[model samples]
Target: MHEPAHARVPAQPLIPAQQKVLRHSVRGQVLDALRAALVDGDLAPGEIYSGPALGERFGVSATPVREAMQQLALEGAVECLPNRGFRVLTRTARELAELAEVRALLEVPVMLRLARTVPVSAFESLRPAAAATAGAAAAGDLPRYADADRSFHGQVLALAGNDQLVQVAEELHRRAQWPLPGAARIRRADLIADAAEHSALLEALIARDLPVVESLVREHFAGNPA
Candidate 1:
């Protein structure tokens, strides 16, 4: 992603309180936090990130920081430099479009099949994911909203019983998450509409309406119908 015109480093980097380590939080938890930070724009795209600095922010040693970043690199979220650290990598517009196409091809089929096969009762447990998405959207919390978006979609796809499929779909989803042009200027209406779609999609699924489910899935990419 291109740097925003007004981009400037903050006066102070985030420093998580050491006392906040409540109960030996694992590396996965740290990874989740870092991922959320990226989605929330707490970590700017195109910025260089050092493991030690991030370690300080997370109140942990550099090892876990590096490890977590390594995982992100594998997922194409960041690129590591030998002597330096990692650079956040956002897909170009064309690249994101291609990914969206591929994602729709893969995601839509599974969704359609599940709509016809899975009982509506099986989806009752997914209410929380949908609710979280609505809550995040209503509050305009991008990180929380993005994570909930993933949860709702992932849960929907899990009926396929393919862990690898979910992982790949998630990678593509993350790539499409870079801030749009004038991201800070995004309107409340857009966010509300985006969040509301989750509930609509869920209702479509529960109703076993394959056609509506397919359309909703395609529109999840927003204006890029597959």
Candidate 2:
């Protein structure tokens, strides 16, 4: 069956499952890179990026980059420009405020409920995630800080034992973090202050201080601008 050495298949070939896994791995890596670029302002708002160009930048095929851009479009981070490409959207303060309101409506009550019933040990366990945000902020690493921030919140909400709620809340959280055009750059001091609130909220949760938790939660959402 080996008509020519050059035409012969490799001794070990990737199975269908393995191929799918490899594809997913590449797609995930591309997606993370795109998200990091967005957070770092490397992909500026209102910029138009084609899949091929992004693929060249990330050293992958256009497929994964386009897939990642599609996901970003679904998350409201970008707008699909028909046959052209994707345009990074500039988030408005009003849009961000609306998102904050929705997140507050969903999470505040759940957090308060969990504070009253969940064990203090559960809150204690999330301290490391909370601390990670502070470290990321200290380094002025916005992408890392964003990830740590989301992880900290996700961990806190996962205590409710509702996967659907966690997914929806996280989606909203990501949308709120998108960059705004003409807005002042986020200062490291501001990031540090915001990161500190995570620990403060955790402390209130551990203490079972309902009023303090509610106040902190509301203020946290209010102070955040998109």
lDDT of 1 by residue, 39-120 (tens): 6566666777877777766667777778888988887777898767888775566877787799899998999988888888
Evaluate model 2: give its lDDT. Answer: 0.81
Q: Which ten residues in a row have the lowest lDDT in candidate 2?
A: 2-11
Model 2, span 1-226: residue lDDT tens: 3111111112222223234457788888778877877776777787787777666655567798899989998888888887677888897889889988999999999999999999999999999999999999999888898898889999999999999999999999888887777666688998999999999999999999999999998888888532
Over 4 Å off, model 1: 1-26, 180-187, 223-226
- Candidate 1 collision pairs: none
State the lDDT at 114 in candidate 2: 98
Off by over 4 Å in 2: 1-21
RMSD of each: 4.3, 9.5
lDDT of 2 at 15: 28
